[model samples]
Structures are given as structure tokens and as C-alpha cells.
Target chain A: MDPASILLGGFASGMVLFIVSVGLSVTMGLMGFVNLAHGGFAMLGGYVIVLAMKHWGLSFVPALALAFFAIAAFSVVLERLLYSRLYRAQELDQVLFTIGLVFVMTAAVTLGVGPETQVIRLPDWLRGQTDLGFMTYRTYSLALIVAGTLLVIALWLGFERTRYGARIRAAVDNRRMAQSLGIDVGRLFTVAFALGSGLAAVGGGLGAEILGLDPNYPLRYLVYFLIVVAVGGLGKVTGVFFAAILIGVLDFVLKIYFPKGGTIFIYALTLILLLARPHGLFGKRGT
Target chain B: MDAPHTAAGQLARRHRFQWWELLPWIAAIAAFFAFPTYLAFGTQLLIVILFALSLDLVLGYAGIVTLGHAAFFGAGAYTVGMLASQLGWNEPLSGLLAAAAVAGLIGFVSGLVLLRTHGLTLLMLTLCTMALLEQAANMGAHWTGGFDGIPGLSFDKILGLFSFDVLYFRSQYLYVLAVLLLCFVAVRMLVYSSFGQSLTGVRENLLRMHAVGAPVRARLVAVYTISAALAGVAGGLFTQATGYVNLSVLGLERAAGVMIILILGGYGRLYGAFVGAVAYMVLEHMLAKAYPTAWQLGIGVTLILVALYARNGIIGIGEALLRRLRGGGQA
Candidate 1:
């Protein structure tokens, strides 16, 4: 493939990763909870879109929106009932619980829907290539790039400008201190968790074509999502964006050149980078 | 509810053989004669218990949580398989030794790099290392057999005296049980030693241990290497007993399965492995027999429930119940 096409493909892939991983970053940073089930929420969103489009005759865009809202709403219940109980639990417990959730999600999906890959049909506008002044790119790829960029800007504003974002940031920095300062840390956690799940939902709905929607989606792409979060330095949006892009681009380009060793290279890279900076690339020192 | 670390030192200093500790061995021997026909399954269960025991050393005692222990297990299995199939060095005893050495070397080397970090990063690195090994194994499929796995692997008799398949795999069952017993004894010794107490200190609080002049990093690496070597022995036993090797040995599922076993059995406690392997295997067998598709679901529910409520596993629950019963009787 041409360099431009590879870059576009990588860019699109990175956006999907960023969208999926950004929520995990938020939860990990804000709540200090290792929510490995983040991918489960994403998988659920993919199913929602699939079921809506297939059974309800809903259009792709509407289905995606429905998936976003539905998963966000659903995750709030999960947060209150399941995740909240484990907020103060050890990292090992959190890991086990969430991994269990992943298994449950996988089995539930398999039992509910057949254990086959679910594909979404794109609208006519997203079906073909779009010719830009500089070059022609897949319309879907361009759409993803646009969506990712817009999401990034929106997240930046939300985190940097809004009062709620400030409270969330406070909780991330120090939950006890934030609570002492009269911040409703619990409420912040709920809202942030919901938003993160919602973003994951959108990413799942959008990236299903590239990442593939199946019963095994969570486990299959778990390492990828984790790499994004860990390398991006926990909870920062910009860090996740850059890290996602770097990983996505490298993975995409390397797979094209050295298909067998591409994933191997990424895994090795993650190991080395984390070893070099245990806290992550953009993560603060002493954390 | 007593923490393992807090009790570790006192247990290590005053630990002596208890009459109750003989129960598991008695049961093992009893099963050998009781079933007589199920040696193959017994051998498999023994291998799994051994594997879970190795994990307990690292995760439960040393306090290093990981998701990549199958790297060592797979390494050992592959080592034995490769040595036997390619070089025709099929001596079962020698093969087990070689497997342990190779896996221990890997553990030592990886531990040096992996032990530098703690918590999630360490967990991720271990995972990456395992993934790296799996990919390498895949790429080196010429020898490792990639996905198809090594089949038709043959091993010589135990000590040149007993055939593996003869008498309904009696020799295999005896051989595996003997090895498991030996390893279990060694583990018991280690866990009750001063070094073991130091490991518990490291696990309970790294900074406190370091401040108290403990070589925390070295202790962790040593325990990790030992654990990996033990796991390798289990893998070697598995390959020898089964006469086959496969890629799933290194897969994430196997890694997770072993961890689940340890958790269910109540890690850090020596007998947890035996209890966990029996429970998990029995549950899995029943689930598979009744509804193959629901097996994964069963495992999922078991894990979630265990993590949420039974964090220390069956042994922990048993301990709690015993304590409550004794207290009520006293009242």
C-alpha cells in the first residue's frame, strides 16, 4: 500500500483505539480503578448497534447514537452496583472482577447472539473514497479522523475549561483532598465513568469494521487498549491521543511490511517503554 | 481474616510438621487405589495443582500479581518436547530437569527486567513477555509447531524401570505424583523459612521491608525464578504424561485458568493448590459434560463471585467458617 493510504489507515485505526481507550484512562486516573471490563462496555455497544440496525431497521448513524446513550446509561447502573463496591478494593481484586466481567460479557454475547462476527453496513456517503485537494482517502477513514479530532477538542475543553472537569481532575489528583475540599468526588466518579463508557460505546460502534465485532473482541483487543492507556500516562486525553496514534500507525505500517512480527514489535515496545518509565510517558513523576 | 504477611514470620520461625498436613498425601495415595482406572485424569489434576502451587509462591507469597505465568509453563513443556522430538533425548527424568532449568533461566532473566516495576506495569510487562514468547514460538514454528503444536512426543520410561502407558498409565500416575510430592515438600520448606518470611515482608510492604534492610528486589527475583522453575516442572510433567504439546499451553486462557485455580484454592496457603485444582477440575468437568458452551460462563461466574466475595478462595471461606464455629462453641 502507498504511504498515504497506510497513514490514513493507521490514523483511522488510532482514532478507534483512542476512542476506546480514553475512557479507561479516565477511570484509571480519576478513580484509581483498574477497570479491565472497559472493553466489555465497548463490546456491548457494538452489539447494540448491530441489534438495532439488524432488527429495528435503524440507520447506522442512529444506531450508533442509540448505542452511545444506551451503554452510557447502562454503565451508570453497573458503576453504582458493581464497580462502586470495588473502588476501594486492591488492584488484584479489581483486575479479577473486571476480567470476570469480560468473561461474562463474552459468554453472554455468545449465548444471546450467535458467536459470529457482526458487521455494520455503512451509509452510501461512507462507502467509497473521498477526493481531497491533497489526496484521496477512504470516506470512512476521513470520517473517523474528523470524529477523533472533534472528540479530542471536546475532551480538552471538557477537562480544561468546565467546572465539572475541574472537579474530576481534582479527584484524579487526590480523591481525599478533593473530598476535603467539598468536591462531590462520588458524583464526579459516576459522571466520568458514564462519559468514558459512552465514548467507548461510540468507538466500538464505529471501529467494529476495523477491529471486528465478535464474542472474543474484548480479549482480542485488550492488550491494544491497555497499551494505549498505559503508554498515554493514565488519564490524559492528549497523551492517549498521541500514544494511540503512535501505536496504531506503527502497528499498521509494520503489519503491512512484517505481518508476523507487527504485534510482536508492539508488545516488545510496550514492555521497553513501561520499563523505561513505569509511570508512563506523560505521567507525572512520583506517581 | 488474618493477613498472610503478618503471620508469615511467626509461621516461618515456629513452623513444624502438623499431623493434618498428611491428609492431602493420604488422599492422593488413597485415590490411586480407590479409582485405579482414572490415573490419567489424576495425573492431569496433579499437574494443575503443581502449576497453581508455583503461582501461589509468586503471587500469594511474593505479592507479584501476574497474568503471564504460562510463559514458564509453556517454555518448560516446549523444552521437553523439543528435546525429545528433535534430539531424541526422551529420558523422562532428564527431560523434566532440562525443562526446569530452561524455564528458570527465563524467569531469572525476565524477572530482572520485570521486577523493576510494580503493580499494573509489572503485570503488563509479564503479559507482554508472555505475548512475546507466544509470538516467538509462532514465528519459530519450524520447531515449536506454531499453532498445530507438537504431537506424537514420546518419552522413555521412568528411571528406565517403568513404562508410561503400561497398566493403565500406572507408571505415569505414580511418576507425576512422586514429582508433585517432592516439589510440594520443597515448597513447604521454602515457605516456612526465613527467606520465605523475608518474601512475605516484601509483599506486605515493600518500602517497610527495604527500610528494614531487606533486599526486596533480590528476594522477589529469587522467588519468581523458583516459582517459574516449579511451574516448568509441572509443564514437563504434563507433556510427558500426555505425550503431546500444544500452543494453548502458552495461551492467555491457560494463564488465566491457573490463576483462577490458585485464587479459588486460597493462595498463599500450601494446600490451596490441591483444593483449587480439585474444585476447578470437577466443576469444569461437570460443566463441560452438561453444557459445553456454558463452561466458559461457569468459569466467568466462578471467578467473579470468588473475586467479589471469596477473595481468598475456598480455603479462606473454610477458615472463616471454622473460626466462627469455634467462637460460637466457646460462647
Candidate 2:
């Protein structure tokens, strides 16, 4: 019932959503590929972190880094072998292929680690409540907010200020023209795909406690990711950031009042918003 | 001499009954006698065929990409479930009609808002609509039976003559077969109709259809309603056959499963439902039995292979073989 806690909790949830979904936007908007398996990679990332900490006796921070690098490397291989082949395919084919991947991934995860929820124990510094002068908030939520803000800044600088980021932007704007201008658009795409998927992995590792990791993690949260990307305007980092926060807060607050019908409201809102805009909140007409 | 060359003649030729079309019907009937012990499975196959056919109408023919066609199917099911269990309206025939009506109404209402968007937005909207319906059903657990589902639903005899025989399942099989026949005939007629051709035009190019004054949205809405109604009937039939209804009817898994069936058989072709259902059921039956736990791996591999190599599905592969046999290269 407390507004501050609601805002803090919802904002933290939103940050996780943004981290996981921004890669989807990049793949969907820039590559023009309907990669539904993005969540599968995120799920793998969760498993990577869980396994690293549980079995290897690794610390939480190292496990998080390992999740990012491991999933990133794995995603690059998948991009080259599986995804690149279907770049020119129809939306239907892309959807089917990615969904197929999700199925395989889910089945594999379930087989490997029984069909149970994987819970991670947070370190002392990251657990419990912290006084924010105005009100007390969960230290985990505060950490998520700070970490998410840092990522946003890092992404902004990477995309806006760096030559590589500018090249990625140019490629997304127009592939053929970017290629004609001596940019290796294909290689650029692979790098972007890795980073995007890696970021999703990091998000999954961080949000495993909140999101609940299981065999069906990919399918369970696929909608939230899609909502973030679609409502934010595909490929727009800032747009996804705002959309994720809005959806997260709305979902969190609504659930407090109407536990059973909170998701119903979200779905209805998405229907109306998409019907009116067709594109998204920040999308231009054609793109 | 020029009859085949004229547009009207070509339409007539395409609509004309083919002798080979009778083979499937004969096979369906033959299964009743051949598989006397497997009547229950036979009935399920018929229901799946009907469900897939309904989806083919919307997704394959009308070209609407929906991830939640199960919404209509679930609507039809809960309609039957609620009416029979709660209101004591247990007549099989009337219950099905009510199911179709309720499902069609939902399709019409949702389609009005849903058909406005295209691509990913439209896809998301359809999914949202289904999710909303599922949530509503879950919230109204008292009426819907919640996740436990509406069970112990009893129906009166078909036409008040043949009672449901749980032991033999003969009457259930025949009744479902009859309904499937009627639905298939109606779908065949609709597909060959000028209205159906106009839907194809809309699918091919929405802007061109708009420019040509083809009332694109109305046609879409009409087909969507009809498809929903048919899916509802399938759901109603499922409830009647088993005398049970569950929330899984509206689950995302069912939605995805139906799409997988359509893709396996090759969508856009009228017979795809028949081929796809048979393939899917048989594979699911065998793989689930064999693996017990990891059968989905088989399905996943099949889907990926189909998407990568056989974009058009099994039917497409057959057509390609036929083309090669006739020495027609890539027609």
C-alpha cells in the first residue's frame, strides 16, 4: 500500500525487464528478425549463474560476469550457425524457428535440472532493507536501480558516442547503404547480437530471484519482453527503458489492488495501446 | 474449347468435385470399423482435425497471424461447460450451437479492435486478447471451476436417441464424425466461394485490395468470426466427447500446438488440416509413449527442420515431389 515501496519495487522490476528486452529490440528492429528465442538465451544465462555459484562455489559478482561472457559467446555461435541463415525469411518462419528453439531449450533445461524453481541466495550487502533518508527500500531493489541506470548510461555512450555504436546505428537505419559505405554490416550484426543477448543474460542472472527461474522461464516471460519491445518502439533503447518501467510499475501496482486481474488489465491496456498506435510509443511511421 | 481459359470457367473447374477428395472421407469412415478398440483416439483425431481446419481458415486462408486462436476454442469449450454443468442445458446439439454463437460473438468484438494493426502489433494484440479471456476465466473460478476445470459434464443423447457410450465410444465417434463432415463441407464451400477469393486478395496485398474497394476489414472480420465459431464448435465437441473442460484449452501451449500442427501439414492448402492433424497426433502419441518425458524434443526438432528446409510443410514437400515426377522444374 505504500507508494514509495511500490515505486521502488516496480522500478526495480522495470530495470530487469529493460535489460532482458533491449536485446530483443536490437534483434527485432535492427536485424529485422523475429527472434522469439531471445528468452531462451536469457534462461540459459540464469542457469549459468545458478550453476556457477552453486557448484563451483563462485561469488555472486563473478557468477554474474561469467553469465554475461558465457551466454554472449554461446549466442555468437548460434547467430552464425542458426540465426544468420533465416535473416531473409518470412516472419512466420522466423517465429516458428525461434519458438522451436525455445521448446528445445525448455526441454533441455528441464531434463538437466528437474522442473523446479531455482532460487539464488543474495549476499548480505544485497539483501535486507536500506534507509533512503525518505523511506526504507529493499537493498536488492536499490542495487537493481543503480545497476540498471549504469547500464543505461553505458549503452547510451556505446551507441551514441562510439564509432562502433554509430556503425551499428547506420546499419540498422539502412543495411544496404551501410554495406555500400565499406562497413562490414554482417560482422557488425554478429557483434550487436552477442552484446544484446549478453545483456539479456545479465538481466536474467540479476532478476532470477524476482522473475523466478524454471524450465519454462523463456515462455513465461516472453510476453513481458515482447511488450517492452513493441510498446517501446523496436530498436529504441530509451523507448524500451521507459516502456519497461511503465509496464513494470503498472503491473506491480495493479497486482497489489487486483491480484487475479492485474495481468488482465495489462493485456487489455496493451491491446488498446497497440490498436491506437499500431507502431509504438516512440516509433516513426515506416520503420 | 475455351471454357478452361475463361475466369468463370477456371473458377468452376477449381470448385468442381475431384474423385480423389473422396479418399479422405472414406478413410475417416474406415477407421471406425478398422480401429474398433481405438475409438477414443479416433474421436480425438476428429476433434483435432476440426480445430486445425478452423485455424486454417483464419491463419492459412485469411492470413491473420495469431498466437491465440485457442481463445475461440476455449470460449466455445467453456460455453458448453458452463451451460451444461451450471444451467443444466445438456443437449448436445443445442449446446454446440450456443458455443459457436458465444465464440463468434467474442471473435467479432475482438476482431474489430484487433484487425486494425498489422505485423508484430497485431500478433501481440491477438495474444493479449487470448490472455485477457484466460485471466477472466481464471478470476471467475466459481463459475469456470478455475484451474480444476468443469468436470462431470453430462450431455443428453445425440437427437435423444443414441446415448453416450463411455465403454464403446461408438456413438461419440459417429457424432463427432458427422459434425466434422458438415464443418468440412461448409469450409470447402466457403474456401471456393468468391468471398474466400477476396480474402486471398486481401492476404496477398492489403493496400491493393483497399484501392480496389474490397471492404478488406469487413471481410477479415467476417472470416475471423466464422473461424472462431468453427473453433468453438471443435471445443464444444471436445467437451461433449470427454464430458470435461479444463483451463488448458485456453493455454498458450494449445495455441502453439495448433500452429505447429498447421505448419506440419502445410497451411494455406485446405487439406493441410487433415494431414497435419494425423501427423501431429501420431508423432505425439508415439514420441510421448517412447520418451515419456522428453518427447517435446522430437517436436522441437521437427519444427526447426520444417521451418528451415520445408517452409511450406509436408504438403509442400509432396507437391515438390509431384512436380519433379512430371519433369516440371520449380513451377
Q: What is the interface RMSD of candidate 2, in Å?
A: 1.1
lDDT of 2 by residue, B1-331 (tens): 4475688677668887899999988998899899999899989999989999999998899899999999999999999999988899999999999999999999999988788777889888888888998988888999999878998888898998999978778999999999999999999999989999999998889889999999999999999999999999999999999989988899888888888898789988999999999998999899999998788788888888988999888999999999898886545
lDDT of 1 by residue, B189-261 (tens): 9998889989888888888998989988898999999999999999999899998898888888899889878
- CAPRI-style class, candidate 1: medium
Give Cα distance to truth, residue A210, candidate 2, Å: 0.7
**Candidate of highest DockQ:** 2
Candidate 2: list runs displaced more than 4 Å. Answer: A170-184, B1-11, B328-331
In model 2, state the lDDT of residue B149: 90
